[model samples]
Each structure stands twice: as structure tokens, then as C-alpha cells.
Target: MSGTLEEIAGSDHAALARWVEAAERPAIVRGIAADWPAVAAARAGDEAIAAYLSARDNGNPLTVLVGPPETGGRYFYTDDMRGVNFRSEKMPMAALVERLLALRGAADAPSLYAGSTPTPESVASFATENPLPVDTGVDPRIWVGNASRIAPHYDMAANIAVVVAGRRRFTLFPPAQIANLYVGPVERTIAGQPTSMVDPDHPDHARYPLYAEAERHKLVADLAPGDAIYMPPMWWHHVRSDGALNVLVNYWFGQRQDRFPFAALMLAMHSIRELPDSERGAWRTWFDHYVFGDGAVHAVDHLPPHAQGVLGPPSPQRDRMVIDYVVGFCRSGGSG
Candidate 1:
């Protein structure tokens, strides 16, 4: 059943890290960044926060997506799904903030969003001034916008998102709800990841009947300026940013897979999806035994260690061999 997210206090960094690592579901951390300068600035007013960020601007132009008011701040595909509804503009962080502030009270202001901009590149001192409690190897990225809705999409790695300014609402669904979400095209997507066609805010139940099933498993979280949320890998989430100006800082970690799973899925679809039912079923069994199933560890135990190759174990040598084989196969036009 759908429910509100569990709340946790981010007082202890070690405890917070442990909890985040073991969490199977998403959790909202209350006032985790209350002491941050950005949050303080946001509390003062939208103009204060804008000035704070602009002061740290590195002068690099960030690509901002601009969507007309007709889309109602929801950036997505056009009617025919041939192209996106938003046009991208490269502008400095200060300029973008000024534009958003100017249209603050407008009833039909165009959606302006600058997503996944590297904090160090755009705002030179942002990372240093507002450091995350725990280290996430990769640098944090900033998402700045004004009153926008992003479709439900899953990330490949685990994420910790902190709301530095304004407010955010996250509607989350577990990975198992994939089938019911009515996912769009994988290759041609609004963003890099394939997003759900059904809008969580206003689901078209008639066109998407199965979304009702997905709605049953939904979990919602409303985050304020200093609040934070932790999401595990592949948890589908639809995000809505409220207020005239919003800023979110997020860190993505635990993405060191040998090969991207989505790329493997695309390759399998090309090679195996159109096969005969019997053949496909047999391949499924093989995949289960060697990939998804627990018995994969011992699947090649019967063979000599020297001859086991990629099936034997996860070692540097085996990983290199697998990579070489894949590269060779692709280079040979998949003849092998």
C-alpha cells in the first residue's frame, strides 16, 4: 500500500551511512542540512539564496532547459513523441537565477531547469562550503529550477539528494513496479533514462490502466530546504520542485559495475528477444542459472580453474578477458 516515507535524523554521520547502506526503501532525513549557508540563505528569502549561489558562480555557462508555459512546467515528449517540448539554452548561473527571479510571481512562467550541473564547474565553492556528511567518491551535481515536474525515472546508482532551497516532493516506486509504470522508449528518452509515460501527478487511468497497480506501491516524501532523501539503486521516482526557485544537490555512488546493465538489456533484446519461444525460454533458464540465481557462484566449479574463464569468478583477469571478448565480438560484426 502507498504511504509516507520513514523519517530519520542525520545527527550522526557514521550511523547515517550505515542506515543508508542497508536501507531497502527510501527515507527522508529531517533537517540534515539545516546548518548549511545555502539553507540559511533560502530561509531568509528567494533573493538571498539566488545571491548566495551567484556569488559562488564560476562563470561557466550551464545548459538550461526552457519549456513553454503550455507544458505547465512538465518537460516531456511532444504529442507524437518524436521530439522533446523543451529547448536548451546555455547561460551562466547568475543570468539564469535573475531570469527565474524576474518570473517568480508570474502565473504562467516558462519552466527553466538546469539539471545535473557539476557543482565545482558551475559554483566553484558550493561543494567546499556545503559538504555532504558522508563521502560518495563522485562529485555532487546541482539541479536548479523553478516549479517543474520530472517524470518517474530510475537511476543506475544509489543516490542521496539534499534540498538546499525551496521545496521538493518525491513520489517513489520500487523496481518491481516496472511493468505497471508504462515505461517509454529506451533509446529515445526525454533524459538519458527511460521515463514513465503516466504522470504521477495526474495519471490518465483510462489510457494507462495498470498504473493503478503501481499507485498502490507508491511512497511519497515532501522535503523542505534542509531536508534530504536517500534512494537505492533502480527505485523509480517522480520529482516535483515547488516555489519560485529550487536548488537540489545530489550524490550518486555505488555504480562501479563492469558493464551497464541497461546496455546488456539492450544487447539481449537485439539478439534474443525475437527468438522462438522455446529458444527464448531455454535462454531464460541459462540466464537465471548463470546470472540472477544464487547458484551462479558455483556454476563453473566443476571446470578446472584455468579453463573456467569468465564463468569461474570475478577477478581482474576474468574481467579483462570478458571485456576483450565483447570488444572482439563487436568489432567482428557479432559474427561470433
Candidate 2:
């Protein structure tokens, strides 16, 4: 019972807020966004959901990916790992809706997908119709397409993905399985983010035997319309859309720059990883004391506000200082 995500009834804003702050694992929030107009319209029919979105469409162009049937609707790197198998185009939300609606019955139509399209960019009033308990700072995005597959990836921000039409299946993995997951190139990516190289639907164990190790850490969730999942930041998730037409609305928040992982990672990579084995060992001790093993997550009672630059409390000024220090280091060859 302690290991599994709690299933709470309804979208209690107070309860959801607490979960966003303290819940350490993924949660299956049943009926959280069920009352959203878009979800309700979707319950009526596929056309209803499409029409609901189109009515509020802002006419913004979102990036859409088109993949041939040979790829089996899976967007991934080419067989040679040199490039992706999909072509991308900037399409208007309303037109994309029409295209998806038209392809509902086409068995051989190329996979058409538009993911991470901002709600404000696609449909300005979409969030008003589908309210979330999260802060306004959280950016809500729309995903629409016929049946398609999204490769496994982790986001920098915490995510709450709500299913509007059709069904979605998610396979999740914790960050601890990064090594076993066989991540793809950081430079060449299918989308803007790095994705797992191993295919979960068809794992070639011989080529990537460690991927089987990742399987043990996998958590599966099958969501219907009105269902949403609370995914903590850095949790890897693989999503697959089912049925003829599918739509998902997701919100991403918790994008705190003060928490400071990326900047620290870049500095360490430039300065530490290339060091001699013995020198690298010394840096690990310093990292433990100052970075990863820091007890800052719990409390700042040990230090006064004045003593804490970035650790005591969060502030925009403190955030700027952290960034400036990192940037200055990079510009000055890390000495000044």
C-alpha cells in the first residue's frame, strides 16, 4: 500500500495542491479533470471534443510530426541512429483538428501528431473550460493526433497529464533506471528532449540487455477520458495513444531555476569528469557535502536568511546570482 500511488476521488484542489507539494510518487487521480468541458464534450463523441477545441482555437501554428506507416506510428531515430524517421510541420490547431478528424477511419494514413502545443497558443480559452488545481504559472499544453506512439522521455518540470478523448497507456520509470534505459543521443533528438533508445513495445534484449533491468522498475497506467496522472519531475514516461482519435491536455509546472541541477551539471561536466581518477574521487566528496547529498530539501533552520544565498529561501534575485556565477565561470575559463 505504501509503495503505490494513492487513488483519490474527484479533483479536490486542496488535496491536489498538497500532492503537488509533497507527494513523492506518481498518482492516478480518478475524475480530477472529468468535469472539464472538453472532457465532457469528448464523452459525447470524438467530433464533440474536436469541435470544442476548434471553437476556442487561437489559430496558432504548433509543430506537428508526420511519420510513415513503415515506422508503425512510432517516432524514433532512424535505423542508423543518424536522424529521426518523422517529418515536422507547423500546422494551425483548427486545421490539425480537421486533419485528425478526417483520418479517424483511415487504416493506412500516415501518423499525424501534435504534442506539447501550448493551450494559450492553440486554444486561448481551453484552460478556462478545463480547470486545474495548479498555479497559473504552470503552462498547459495540448496533444492531439490519431493513434500514435511517443517514445520514453523525462521532463525537467513536474507534469499532470489529463486525457480528453480516447485512451492513453503510460509506462513509467524512475530516474534511477537511466543507465538501464539506454538513452539516445543528447545532440540528435526526435523532439527537443532526449529519449530512451530502447523500444519498450519491442525490446531487443540482445542489443540492449540492460533494458530488461529497466522493466522491473516500470509502472503501467491505462487512463480513460477524465483521468489524469501526477508525475513528479524527472520521472520517465512512455505514452501511447489508442483508438481512432486521441487528445490529451497536460500542465507542466515546478520549473524552478533556483533548485539548480542543469547549471551544476554543466559546470561539473566541464571541470570534473575529465579530471584524473584520483581528482574525480575528491570532487565526489565535495559534491556530497554541497550538492546531491545536501539536506536542504528538508529545512533551512540550520542557517539564517542572511547566511542562505540560494538555499535558505527562493528568490528571483538569488536565482539571477546563481546563473551569473555559472555564466561568469564559463566565460572566464572558470578561474575568476
Candidate 3:
């Protein structure tokens, strides 16, 4: 087993708390299982599973599960399901299923949502369920796979992921651990499979000496079908499949979209307000040096301007705040 894995599986929440306090980063809580039945329901059918497998087999955009009708409700299988609740633009499952089957039948046929081409039904059906007590606009993504892999990347919103069919290995390190993680170019990352800076084992200790000291605060939970993991904001995690088939659903929540413009303004104004052009470029270099590296996954906001690391390291308060921020974001839905 890897040294990082050893630290993760053996450690308790108290140890995690200590790391959080010292590092001012995200923490992981293991073995919290919920809503397995619904996850299985989506993954049950051969057609659905085949469709998903075909998507991945051919390098297509995987299916996404939008929000449910109720708060924390079971995830709806189709994108159009949200149309009934909110005025969403979406491609109905019936049509989407046809698209999937069509692609399977005729490999020459173009894939759905392929390019700049507009999806009129999907665009028209974009909507969200509102008037709920909790912020519930953000649609979550659910996937079922037989030996599938997700490339490393940081999401703009906080994520709560649940495993339903099999096991998975999550290699996580705090954002501060970026220097140690050998990262790749950002342009390559946007396409998918963003990676680390340093080699996990044979790191170039001379170039990134500080990376040696980066604590790999990791946790490897052999999540049974129902278990879930909550990856807090700004945290970096890479996942690998460990079972015959791994089924997972992830919820990403953040404050309203309206606030993002404000957040971006705040970030731009505060971080680089006074730097000259040369210095500004230097700042980007600084960011590229410390936060993003060759093949590494990272958050742009977590860099200098938007916010510094978690206020006081990882504390109960900071954890709560991160959760609130994510859920809040979800409440603010988008047009599609």
C-alpha cells in the first residue's frame, strides 16, 4: 500500500481535525452512507448501464443527473426531469436514449451535445426546482461504471460524492500539497485528466524540495455500496475504480450564480488591483508555480486574490462555512 493510503485508512476524525487545524484545509469523514437504493435504480438497467459505458467507451460526455424535486431527494435519471419543476432547457431521456442508441447503431452518426451545435429541446428545458426550504438548485451528476476512471480536477463548487455499486480509491491531498503534486499545463487540464506537479514517488526533490515536506493527508475508504465522501471546497482529489463496477453520484453546491460575478469582481479587485502588467504576469507565474503545476488540479479562486487558505486552517467552524457556501451555491440555479 502507498504511504499516503496508510495514513488515510488508519487515521480517525481527531487526526483529521489536527491536520485541518494545522493546515487550514479540507478534511474527510469516512463511512457515511445514504441513499443507495436510488443510486442502484439508475444503474440497474442494462440499457442505462450500456449507454453510460458506451459514452465512456467512445469518449463522449457522460450522462448527468440534474436536481430532484425535493430537498436532498433521490436524483432524477434524466436532465428533463427538472423541467417539470423549473423552466429548464433539456433533452428528454426518451430523446437522449434515442441519441445514445443511435450513436451505438451508427458510429458515423454525430453524438448528442457534440459541438457548438445548439440543443433546442435541452436549451428550452433548462430549469430548476425552487421554493424549497434549503438551497437546492444545483444539479448533481451520477455515474455507474464497470472499471471507469475520473481524471483529477478541482470543481468550482463543493462536492459530496456517494458510492453505490462498488469500491473506489480516493487519493486526496490538501491544496497546499500542490507543490508536491506534479501538475500539467492548464489548457490540457480543461479538456480533462488534469494531473500533479511532482511524481508521487520519484519526485524531483531538488526542483521541488518543499514538496517533500508536503503532508499527504489522505484517507482510503473501501466504501461499501452505500457509503459517501464529502470533498470540501478547494480540496484536490483523484479517484480510481476498485470494484467490478463502481456507481457514484456527486452533489455540487455553491452560492447563487448571481453572486459569482460579485465574487469574481472581488477576486479581481482585491488580488491584483495594484500590480503593474509585468508584476501581474509575475503574479500569474507565482500562482502557476505554487498552486498549479504540470498535470495538477487546482482552484483559481484559492490563489492570491479571491481568498487565502481556510481562515484558521481546518476547524469545525471553517468546515461548516464551506458546507454552507456549497449548498448556498446550489440554491442559485442556472438557465441550463
TM-score of each: 0.97, 0.89, 0.44
lDDT of each residue in 108-128, candidate 1, tens digit only: 799999999989889978888
Cα deviation of 308 in candidate 3 (Å)? 24
Candidate 2 stretches with Cα past 4 Å from truth are: 1-5, 134-136, 258-260, 294-321
Could you give the candidate ranking by lDDT, starting with the highest? 1, 2, 3
Which residue pairs in candidate 1 collide?
Answer: none
Candidate 2: tens digits of C-alpha lDDT, residues 1-336 = 112346666557777778779848787778877778888888988788878888888888889999988888899988898778999988888888888888877778889899888888889988776787667376688999888888899988888888989999888888899999888876567887689988888889999999887888788888899988889988888889986668998888878655666556766787899999999999898667555676635455677778877564557887777778768877998697
* lDDT accuracy of residue 4 in candidate 3: 32
Best by lDDT: 1
lDDT over C-alpha atoms for residue 294 of model 2: 60
lDDT of each: 0.92, 0.82, 0.44
How does model 2 fare in lDDT?
0.82
* Candidate 3: residue 100 Cα off by (Å): 14
Error of 2 at 62 (Å): 2.2
